[model samples]
Target: MIQLWTPEITTLLTRFFKANHLPYGQDFPGHIPTGRFSNGKLNPDFVASFLGIKQTVPTSLDPNLSNDAFNGLVFASAGSGYDELTTILTGAIPVPKQLGQFKSYIAKLSRIFGNNEAQNIIEKSLAIISAGTNDFGFNYYLLPMRIQQFDINGFQDFLLKALHDFVKELYKRGCRKIVIAGLPPMGCVPILVRKDSSRPSIEHVWRTRMLMPVLQWKARFTETEEGCCGSGLLEASFLCNPETPVCETPSDFMFWDKLSSKRAAYKAMSHLLVNQILPKLTLE
Candidate 1:
């Protein structure tokens, strides 16, 4: 009897702009443009490469695209959050909607590969869910609804529960291996650090609430004061154009835009994931 092992996995990155490929940053041309928030490769890009899978995971939102489960897919949106209201307010795809897209992708895969093969792939695929920061950055801090309803701790609990449900749903859909990324050092993000020194530090709060081990990349960044692109205040995507003044040494900068980290930072993060995180996931 031939012993079957767990199938190779597909992972999802949740949250806004985390997977946006708009305006096509680098490497990805018009033929395979993405809406990623960063100036170059995000953490997921490196994670995919480290897993020995195809590096460019196509965004599921593209209308002209077809299912390519072997290469993986990115369902995240910039400005999106775990909360439905958050996506509605920011005009980004909500977490639930991203999952819905995954469901649709699975259906298409079933049509092409048959039910059993699709189910095996789904069972083996890794689901990477990155969220929460936007709920704090865009909603609780910038908006008023969540603040009016709950204090910082209360809101954190709400988001944690939402995350819990998201993972639970993925498990229900046959995704056995799920990786939920904890929030980065949001306080250290150039835009926030430059804008508000008085802002209370929530890094500890996020770490504590999530109960997941955090990846540290602070030591790798020398330019923590501002982003490499333009003023680094709020510039991103189209706002960060070719005409925008960039730093002479982008590798030194922690961020490429107001919200997204530079390639160097993400590269460090990818190494951490490959060395520390991926080993436990039992990837082939």
Candidate 2:
């Protein structure tokens, strides 16, 4: 399956938590460090490794790198969302723009491998989309405009419709296999918990509607109150530098940062995706 890391990666590295100094290397064979907002490998890295694909999914935004569709490309950027306004506000690449880049990549693949081969690859490829978290965390709740325009349920509907359109566009581009990730329980996230625990639990109606599955997962974690890295209150990305002390035992903690899951948590999630989620997707 071909992979893409659009605004998700950018947001994770640049804006979300800021892990600028982290080196990009295959420190874990199949896991390449690209300044992800996590203690170690992100969910995508684990998923790709589990699927026996190449570890590093290169960002398509890089100007120097050759467009190699065989290895897969990451179109996701941090702070990006399903909507254009979200992209504009956050300065992250929009989902539609990422799709546009995908189209270009496909064309490049066609040139290299011929149309039939490129089409075959595209049809067989699995596209994993992990977005919408920023839409809520960065835009709807954080910004005044979206909240003013629509109430909780209404905004949820709007975002869902946008997601529908994004999937439709991917289908149109000959992508048959697609997996759209749902939002995690925002209440349990370290940043939200530290900021205002009551808000994520009570005010976030969107979380209440879609958090059952995540809540079930929550029962597995013991360190729900804080992150594993540093103080866990505000430390994240670059803020979690060398000077900052880390937990002696990370396995005891569920999160690695203000908004990211630890390696152990990702491992559990990867297991779920492989055992439970993949089987169903493969069946389809």
Candidate 3:
């Protein structure tokens, strides 16, 4: 299974008020390390549990963690993105580096399981990708401020190209089933709402401006932001301020935070996968 370029660990750690921010540390290994971007489990772990697979494999650091965990492996970093430039924010392992790690893992599997078994392993794998939010949230919206270079469309195009390339690489690596998630509404994230609000606006301009672009792009992907449990702009506000009153039901919302989705969002994503993408892939 693939769980690439997500901060599931980091978000959970921050939820407990930990300030150290372990997920972004560059020294953290990519494949089977114990120091996953958080204090506890990551989204992959939960996903593994749901699949009835062994808990997600670590980044290649923990000697105890084995390659046989999920009948494959996971090569995700807390804040990495599909693009190289986007990985700079958290100093996490970029997708290229993770691909290299996958190569090494494949080599070891080949040595132990023989060529046919290894090939079978590679062919039947499911790749789960959750990225792009960092590209907008940290790179375009936060850091140098991409609004200066291009409008939302240009930036979305750039991100989609990166994703396209990443998917192509996976196809080269013998993966046919690809599950890619679109960006959640990031504007209402507490980080953006609180930060952008400091700027001038008419009617929650900070939130509306930040979210609309992402929402537009959501329609481009098979799994849309609409009716997602935890990923909409409205939902993000509620999640970031759990104590505050904004939206009553989070199931229809899209964003879980600035960078992720609620359980419902994943369900929507999965529905698209099982119903739309999987059939096409099977035909391929």
Candidate 4:
């Protein structure tokens, strides 16, 4: 979370400037905006639905949330990444602070369910961790803040180490069923593409080569190049605010904005990964 007298993220939540929660959810099934970066549900929400735990996985920071977190909840920050600097620059929650929030969530659980049951709940729950894209896109590729210290390869290594450490911390805290989503095609994103970044990182090698049935694209979507948002070249976040014109049919597009995929794309990925992850998380 952003450091202050008290932690706050004024841009999306916490005081008033909610940039992402207006007409942004125009394509959502419920037609309700919930501050997510996309037009509708995220992959984690679809994952929860696939697992039959809940139709929607609530965020941990929901203002009206109660003590019962048994079905699980999201603890993600939209613009955050593996690097603390990346998070700091965007006023998003950092990795360590996210863990701290999890610790607090556990303590609350302990008070309600008792220590043993709380620990048991954590162990039985499934955790989905998604990050790293912003580390390369925001820090290295966009700003060159970390480029002064590390090349793209070195930055990738540093992020991988940070991710390992985060996962280890989660394991220590009793998370047994954990799934990590790797980087998306960031170089092909409208924002990065407009930035003139065409060269893909080494991760692209595996992303293009690996023959994983789970992640294999079915090619259901036709619009792979431009986002549905205005101009489909540079609009993202605040730039993709209300009053901006969007395409009539977003489901045909792979991306909703400059950075994120459309809800349809996430739903597709959710279906694929759920089959792969469900067996592992459910079996013993």
Q: Cα lDDT for residue 154, model 4?
A: 89
lDDT of each: 0.64, 0.68, 0.53, 0.68
What's the TM-score of every candidate structure?
0.81, 0.82, 0.61, 0.84
Summarize candidate 4's per-residue lDDT along 177-207 as a digit string, tens digits: 7778777656666665656545555644543
Query: What's the CA error at residue 1 for candidate 3, in Å?
Result: 3.9
Evaluated against the true structure, the overall lDDT of model 4 is 0.68
Q: For residues 1-284, could you state the per-residue lDDT of candidate 3 as single tens digits?
A: 54443544332222332213322221223422243432234455555545556545444433465546436356766667766776666666677787787777778778988878877777877777878777776577666656687798998887788778878887887777667766655655544655566656564554455444434433332232232322334333123332323234443355434444444334334444455555666522
Predicted model with the maximum TM-score: 4
User: Cα miss at 190, model 1 (Å)?
Assistant: 1.4
Residue 96, model 1: Cα distance from true site in angstroms: 0.7
Ten contiguous residues with the weakest lDDT in model 1: 1-10
Per-residue lDDT over 1-284 for candidate 1, one digit per residue giving the tens place of the 0 to 100 score: 00011111112333323334332255343433345556566666667777777665556655556544455777766667787777645667678887887788778778988999888888878777777777887788877898999999999899989988887878887788777777766776666766765656675355233422322454355565577777645676556655677778766766777667766666676677678876887653
Name the Cα RMSD for model 1. 6.5
lDDT of 2: 0.68
- In candidate 4, list every pair of residues with a backbone clash: 1-93
Global fold similarity of model 4 (TM-score): 0.84
Model 2: per-residue Cα lDDT over 171-232, one tens digit each: 98889878888776666567886777555445555544453343356436556567766665
